[model samples]
Target: MSRRLRRLPAIVLPLLLATTLVACGDDDGSDSGSGSTDALHGITITGDVGKEPEVEWDGELKVDKTATEVVTEGDGEKVAEGDQVSAHIWIGNGTTQEKAYSTYDQKQPESVQASNDLSPVFKDAIIDRTIGSRIAVTATAADAFGEAGNAQMGIGNKDTVLLIVDLMDKQVVLDGPEGKEQPAPSWAPGLITEGDKVTGLDFSKAPEPDRKLQSATLIQGEGDVVKKGQTITVNYLGQVYGGKKPFDESYSSAPASFAIGVGQVVSGWDKTLVGAKVGSRMIIALPPAWGYGKDGNPDAGIKGTDTLYFVVDILAAS
Candidate 1:
């Protein structure tokens, strides 16, 4: 699943850097409810609601305890505690003035739940926030990850960590495409049987490849037409033209969600899926020029002259 077709630049950093923990005894130094705005004193953030941001601070910033601040007030729906918050996140080592993690690099947001199991620093940052809100959380390395700190991320035990979160909309993911069924073209790829809806594609009867981009809708949805710059959720399967084996598919796993028509995906997907309505099911073909170009995604076992064929089910968009 970790392939170039899903993400050209593969950088998926977790909200918290993971490390094994060994409990020696009961510790009373928990960061929950130990929130304050003292850490935001000299920190400055600049960016729009749905874009990556810039964080700057004077001197060496330090956080003895976890702190939280609302940089921008959003007028969207309130997210109840324990509910999932789908957000684009960025984290930097304030002590080192170095960037550590960001979802913005992949143009994708991940759904994070703010429960007691989550780090107390993160719970304070995400709980009870409204969609479209911009928030900042600062903490000592111990409160953020653990006392050991994340050595791989260049964070030390005494370093301060700054995290910025843009609360994106509640992600809408579907098992499969659901909409009005329509007749498919004769030359289009056929579906493989399962219990009901499926993403397994069959290209046995498909014709030879061509030098053009083409698409055909198999199901017409009643939802809003997808627009450029919208982050879309979809279950898709892709194959090299005339090949029986698929290069990629999301049939049994979680749906992929990313910004569309903004170069987050290949040109073929941006062009064909932007104008499509949510819940629509379509099959598309992308010649090398519209697909991987001359490189042809060598990592995906595709050649320089191959065309990529895909069957996509548009689940939702925001």
Candidate 2:
């Protein structure tokens, strides 16, 4: 669950006013309603949206809705009362041109329910929103983001917020073990012969010490050639090269399935797993650039410059 901090209404009002003045240029002709069509003047993209954005606050603010324009987009399946939904959202300052927040942080698209905590506006805005429908909303600092408005996001008090929300799909979560973690796979007791081959790597090697993110070999599994976009599963363990021990690991035999080449995995996994084959045992050395950046896992005693090692197995591919 995401951490939500609600600001006091008193503290919020002054910040909201400051952000509005700085971002919206006097607010001389702005509307008062949170759903005003003419709230935003324009929108722009500052960087490549295809990559994992370093910051989400670079998209320009653009609002072009007529007075009669309704927020509904006739695209997604009708959102039932308790349906599950996921989205790629972008929030921007209409006047300052700064981005405020987004869900692009998710390696995969984020999943949310129709609960109040997911998004206050989504419950009402998405009732009629169809799949693939694009919706844009312009709301005042208070109306859109409640008391924790754009001021906290670095905007002035009166700054209108432009929210370009994409309602991707509505899904029903299976109530059983589909969402549960799979059990670990057992290691083959016998020696891994030619049957153990690399799954996706055209080449494999030991990672150099202090390397950012390099591929490592798994001790078991057949190294069959794997292709991009294929889903694969494997069990693995991660450790700091010279530190205590494996602080993270997958189920022993149950490898996780993920779409390769896509941003589904971390930057290192996507960069190194290009042509690896299945049934292969490999090790990887990950540098801070390829691993977690400055914010190392304090609990694991991994520092910014520390390298990581992983013994991975390519058990199965889809």
Candidate 3:
């Protein structure tokens, strides 16, 4: 049975850029020409880890079932369940031997959790693998997308899919604060205690919106200062001015990771969080102009006129 795709919480992080699967013919299970003993013999890939691979295959490349080969074994930490893994993947069509999607084109690794939501073959091949590993896997239609296949990707019930993945980094999910505790700023609008399980926000008296962004450090960190354009992982809580409760919080969910100053998040976060040291706690108040302007996120119970308030904990940055 095909498993349901679990949607992750809203964050600025980029997961998979493209997942296109298409239907193709079956292979005879015979060697085409290459001397390799693997089921996929005609195909040959040449490239270093972290770079776009050059694929050479002529005739129809097909696999009757799922198979995986470790191109390069890494020396880094082994990946486990619930760990956030960053990888660059190149997917090719088995029928035409043409490239479908590649993260190399974007010049950034897409991060994903090692969960069942991913293809069974893919999750099985990468989990427990060490970082910096290069993996090549072939999956049948049922093992890849599903028996029904995806119409959007032109995938059919019997087609096979090929994937070449470069495992870049892996991070275990953090359960709580990892930095030294500091007192919340007296002038800050919200209060966050180090020992408190839940940090409450008092929006009854809203701070007046200002032309410039207001930011204060609540905890001091010993890590390196964050640089622009680098991806960072964080835990956060957000609320609108004059609201009784927080509209969103990563404290209750997994920490989010995203590149900074890239317009993926609100302008206020892009401006205030950059240059801050990793492991630091910060409070940033965003005016409507910096936040979701005029048409605020109604799903979050934020109005167009509401000012956004945030208490963020910087965890790690790469």
Candidate 4:
């Protein structure tokens, strides 16, 4: 199992939104409506869409197999194969009728590659559904976690799982030609690049920390400007001001993908990278107020008063 599958609690096992690819098995030929007779029969979900839903089950609820039902129809674009989907999910343990996980608590919905490694029940319920649709579905242990049930969530091999999903948005991932590189701004951190690879950074003339966010485009791109709420792929290098070496960079590994403007990352990244065009490289400077606040990220060796610097290459956005 991938780290995404292994680390997440079983309730939100399907909520792994990381960019890494995982191999999935073919469907076992179970009908989407196999358990429709009992679907949504004893269950009730009430609340505004896109927010935490109130779930209640009248009595003992059980499903012998997999099933799906639409709780509310949507009027947006219908989902299709290969679309990167974003959704708010709520899961409950059918046997115990206890709430398991809700993305609403995180304040940000998750985005995943539709039809990729997802349970057949989830794919069937979500595919062809329009954005804004609210759906309820049931999955038998075999349909969900299989023989190795999750012991942490008290789900046994025979336990059934219930899910409520709100289709928030979807986008078709598109590939575009790289944009032409432009000259770096005079005030930006000095950078040495060799055909899109940053080889060296110079901060000798960098400004002193002032607890404010600052940004300068080193290489302007011609592609569409990235917008808030869109998922983007980027390669970046980061370091604390006055550090001997960069703290992190995506060049040595896979490019990072995350939804912008949703606080998925630090506020500095959301503010500086949202409007940058694909193929562009920008340098961002973040003060304590926007970098990590008073409690800096200890694991990264960032301190409460440390200023952070980043040079980011915007690769793709959707």
Tell me the spans in candidate 1 whose CA falls farther than 4 Å from its real position: 1-3, 11-58, 63-76, 80-90, 96-124, 139-160, 171-175, 196-199
Query: Mind giving the per-residue lDDT tens digits that candidate 2 earns over 1-318?
Result: 000111123233222322332232222333433355443343332333223333233355433321111233444476666555555566667667666656454334334445433333444444445656555556555545544555556655456666655666664332211111222222111112233322122112322364534554433333455566544555555666554445566533223444456645546666666666665555666777776667765666678777766556665453
Determine which window of 10 residues in candidate 4 has minimal summed lDDT.
1-10
**What C-alpha lDDT values do all the predictions have?**
0.72, 0.47, 0.66, 0.68
Q: Model 1 over residues 1-318: C-alpha lDDT tens digits? A: 235564355332431322211212122343332244464858889999789998877667776766677888788887766555578888889887888878787676765545555566666556677888888877777777677776767788789888888998765555566788999886677787565446466778878766789999998977789998777777788888777678888777656666788775788888999999998988898888888888777778988799888888887777
CA RMSD of all predictions: 5.5, 12.8, 6.3, 6.2
User: What's the ranking of the predictions by TM-score, best on top?
Assistant: 3, 1, 4, 2
Better of 1 and 4 by TM-score: 1
> 145, model 4: CA deviation in Å?
7.6
Q: Residue by residue across 1-318, what tens digits does model 4's lDDT show?
A: 112101123233332323112323345644553345467757887876677888888765676666787777888998886677778878677888887667777665666556645666677767788899888887765566555555555666677777788988885443322555567655456775666666556778865656668887766777789999776767778878777777777666545566677766778888898888887778888887877778776767878888888888887676
Candidate 3: which stretches are off by over 4 Å? 1-41, 58-65, 81-84, 93-98, 113-119, 140-160, 170-175, 178-187, 192-199
Candidate that scores best on TM-score: 3
- Higher-lDDT candidate of 1 and 2: 1
Clashes per model (N, Cα, C within 3 A): 0, 57, 0, 0
For model 2, what is the error of residue 166's alpha carbon versus the real structure, in angstroms, after optimal superposition? Answer: 2.8
